[model samples]
Target: MAEIKVEKKKPIWPWIIAGLIVLVILYFLFANGDDDEMIDETEQEQVIDTTSIEEENTANWDNNRNDTVGGVDGYLSYIGDESRMGIDHEYTNNAIIYLMNAVQAKANELNVNIDADIEEIRQKAEKITQDPMATNHADKIKDAGSDLTNVIENLQEEQFPDLSQDVQEVKSAVQDIDGSVLTLEQKDKVNKFFDEAGDVLNKMS
Candidate 1:
């Protein structure tokens, strides 16, 4: 019979040390990894927040400029309906609103970005009505601008003479505005409109 030898049990210290080492490695692997992930998550959130703010600012700027252009064009049409053809208030108001919106849409289509100040234009438009003594003058000035714009709208290069006198009158009145409500950009538009209208009117004449 082979003699069975009793094997001595190794000290528990080695096993305990091996287990502690495994735990420490796991803590660094998972716990420290999670901390790194948290930092990445924080960075991603900050980038998203900043993007949202920039988008909001751009939207606000677009809306403001759109409103400003619309208001100015509306005022122009309103006085035109009243002065040129004796259009009633309700029709004039509604038509002016539509025309103004149309102009804004066209500007957008052409990518003619303008940074018009809506509040400032509104204030000036309101002031046009406030001076009782000069109300008619203000109204006439607006009418002249609108008439010129209309003439340009209808111009066909072949018809310019019929509106020659009106074109001259519009130019004179446009120049007389104390400071002018239209922006420099708008003034440029006005000038182009006048040139086109004059060419048409001269041909017609």
Candidate 2:
């Protein structure tokens, strides 16, 4: 009898399973990469939208004009109905700018430099200049208000007392300045500052 040898076949299941696992891993890697790309694109779009909004605001500010100014109010004092005093309120918090503008305009008309007085007022109103809508600095607000009254009085008395008889009215108006919005009384007081001041401005014009 001749010796016979039988050869056994190797199992292919393990190799097939390994190949399927490799395919799954490749698929997941590509899918995650695609997801990251999409996220990046979305972020870029958001940034573009934000940039456009800021640009539109800048354009509006440059093109906007106010024409309803009456009496002593400067036509350029406010863009639209609000008294912006040519200030970009979005970037600035100068609460007393309106008052400052009133005085500056008068000083300019008289060919005088009241920079010292203005700086003194600014120093007294550090809280207001830093944040217009602040309400916490009671003493600071009071002191600044007092300084405003005194400044207006001195400016009027030294320059032309006949121009305005109600220079003291600013004290009441300044007391109500807890925020940017003004009450009727506040507006009237401010108008007093600008009323006769406007006459001087008109003469210069």
lDDT of 1 at 107: 38
Q: Which residue ranges in model 1 land beyond 4 Å of their true spot? A: 1-7, 65-205
- The worst-scoring run of ten residues by lDDT in candidate 2 lies at 63-72
For residues 45-108, write the lDDT of model 2, one tens digit per residue: 9999999987875453232221111322542243123353322223122334444555555666
Clashing pairs in 2: none
Per-residue lDDT for 101 in model 2? 57
Q: Cα lDDT of all candidates, in order?
A: 0.44, 0.51
Q: Measure candidate 1: CA RMSD.
A: 15.0
Model 1 gets an lDDT of 0.44
Q: Against the correct fold, how does model 1 do in TM-score?
A: 0.32
